[model samples]
Target: MGWSLFRRSRIAPGLPVPGRCGPRRHALATERLLLFTPRTRLDVAAAIAASADAQAQGWLGTKADEVLPDPAVRRALLAWRPAGEDGRRIPRELAEPFTPGPDDPLLLVCVRRSDLGYAGALELQHLAGEMGGWLAPGCRGQGLGAELFRAGLELAHTHLGLATVRAGAETGNTASRRALARAGLVPDQGPRRHTLPDGRVVDAVWHRHDTATPAHCGDHQESPRRRPVTRSGSGHRTS
Candidate 1:
C-alpha cells in the first residue's frame, strides 16, 4: 500500500481542506521504516533529544538552542508535539498532546516499525518547497540516510504539490551525498559556503530534485507510496 500524506486538521494552512479527499498527515513508509506525522509531546521530546544529539548539534545548520532552554519554548514545543508519543501502548495519564497550524510542512517522525523507535525526522516547508532531516545515533550505518531523502522527496512532490525540491549537504559529508544521490538528486550550482548554527563554516555541495527535470536528475518521478526512504547520522538540507 502507498503512504498517505494527509493530516486530520491537526496542522496547517496547507493541510487538506475540511472536505478534501486526501489525508491530513503524510504517513510515508518504506521497507523497514515509517515516516509518520509527528503528533505528540513524545515526538517533540524525541525531536528535541535528536537535536541535542552530538551528530545533530555538530552538523545541523539551523538550531533553536537559545530558545530551547526557555520554559516557554518547552511549553510551545510541547504544545506543538501532538500530546504524547506515536504509540497507543502508552498509558492515557502519561499522554500530553498538542495542536498545529503554522507548523506546516509537517515533520514526519522517522520510526523503525519493528521496535517503534524514533530513527529521525523529515521536514517539509510548505510555501518554500524545501525539505530537511536527520537520523538518530542508533539508526546510523544502515543506508537509512537515502531512505530519509527519498521520503523527503515524496513529501515535496507527490504530497506537497511542489514542482521541485532543493537540498544542500556540507562538503565531505559522504553519507549525505550518497543519500541524495540514491534518492535521485543531482549536482547543481549553489552556495558553496554554508554556516552552521554553532558558528562553523563548511563547504556545501548542492543538489536538486524535480518532477520535470531528468538529465539533471539520475532518477525520475516515482511514487513515494511504494518508494523506500533511507538515511542516518547528523545531516542537513538547505534550500
Candidate 2:
C-alpha cells in the first residue's frame, strides 16, 4: 500500500464507457470521513503533503520537496484545468453548483468515522476517463485506501459512464499494487520508463480495470463488487 501511494504525473489513454450505473454526485459517508466539498486549502495541503511525502520514499520516486505549494509546481499540476476559463489552470473551483454531465465527476474526502482519525481523499477526474487519488500518511492504512478506491470506482461506473478504470505505480511500488489489487485492477503491462524532473528514467507499473474486475476487495470477506461505498444522491456536491 505504501508503494501504491506513489503518484507521478505521467498521462495515459482514456478509459472505456462504464456499464449501466447511476448519475453523478452520489455522496459517500462514514462515521469518520465525509465526502463533500468546501474543503479548506489547509486540508487540501495536508492531504497533498501526506501523498507526496509517502511517495518520496523512492517507491513513488518523487522528491519530497515537491509536496508543498509553489507557483511553479502549481502551474505544472494545474494543467488539468481547461485552457480558457481562468487561464491559470489551477483548481479555482472545488465543486460546481450545477449538475454534472457525463464527462465530469468530482469527489471530496474528510475525517468522519469516530474511531478512525484519518483524513484523505481521492478524485476521479473526468470520472469517465481518468482516476487519481491522494492520501495522508495518517489515513493510508486501516483499510482506508480500499475505501477510497471503492468510492472512486462507484463514481466512475455509476456517474461518469466509464467502463474501465486505470491507475499506475512506481515499478517496485508493492504497497500501491496491493491497493490496486484490493480494488480489482490487474497489471495490464507496464514497467514503462518515464522521464522524471531530474532527467532520470523511472520505471512504472501501469494497471487497468473493467466492469468484470473490481477496484477493492471490500470488507475483506465479501465479493469485491459487494463492498460498501458512499455515493452522491444528487448530481454533485461541493464545499
Candidate 3:
C-alpha cells in the first residue's frame, strides 16, 4: 500500500521474532525473490527508493501527505545502519518486529533473486492481519506480482501465525487485483469507499485469503469483482 509513509526512526530495523513461527532469520525465499525482514542499511535504501521512486509513487502514492515534512527526517528514517550485522542479531528498542504482537505491524522488502535488486514491498498491519504491497516499474507485468503477493501470504500465514488475511485495491488497479487472486485471496464482501494517502476518496474492491484453502496457481479464470457503493473509510492502496 502506502509504503512511503511507513517510517521506523524510533526503533532499529526489525527482524523476525524468535518464537512465533520458528526461527526465521530475516529472510523468506520465493522462487524469484527474497523477502527480507529489513535489518540493514542497504535494505533501508532499497525500500525507500522503491517506495519513493517516481513510477511506484504513481500507484502507491509514495508521496504520503502527512509526516516526513523535512527532507532530513525522511532521509534519517530511510537510512540503513553501518555495515557488519548481516547475520548477527543486534538489539534495539522495537515498535514492531516481523512477527508482531498485538498493535504491531510488519514491513518486508521484496528483492529480485537474480540481481539482488529491490522489486517491491509488503506490509502486514497492526494485529489485524491485513496485507498490502507494490512492485517496481521494471518488475511489473513480468508475472512477478503474483510472486510478491505469495511472499506476503507466506509471511502472514506461515510466519506470523495468522489464519486469514484481507487486502483492498483501487478499482482501476487490475494488476494488483490479479496478483491478490493468484495468491488465493478471492473476492469477499466489503465496502467500496477507500481513502487515498492524498485524502481523495475512491471506489475499491476487497478480497480475502484463508490459510485453509490453497491458491490456484496459474489459474487465470478469475478477475477482481466489481462491487456496489458503500461508506468511505481509511484504507491502503494495494494496487
- lDDT for each of the candidates? 0.57, 0.43, 0.56
TM-score for every candidate vs. truth?
Answer: 0.68, 0.53, 0.64
lDDT of 1 at 98: 38
| Among all candidates shown, the one with the greatest TM-score | 1
lDDT of 1 by residue, 115-221 (tens): 55667777765455556777766677788888888878766676655667767788787777888898888887766777776677888777778896322111222
TM-score for candidate 2? 0.53
* Winner on lDDT (1 vs 2): 1
Q: If the candidates were sorted by their lDDT against the true structure, best first, what order would they fall in?
A: 1, 3, 2
Ordering by TM-score: 1, 3, 2
**lDDT (tens digit, per residue) of candidate 2 on 90-183:** 3445322333343333545444344322255566554224455555554555665555666666655544445666666655656666776786
lDDT of 3 by residue, 1-239 (tens): 22223333311234322122222233465667667656554554445555564445555554465323445543543332322223433234322323323233456677665555567677766255577887655678888877777777776565555567778877787888888888778897776776667656667888877877433222111112212323222125454
What stretches of model 1 exceed 4 Å from their correct place? Answer: 4-24, 61-94, 103-105, 213-239
- Each prediction's RMSD over C-alphas, in Å, is 9.4, 14.0, 10.4
For model 1, the run of ten residues with the poorest summed lDDT: 214-223
162: Cα error in model 3, Å: 0.9
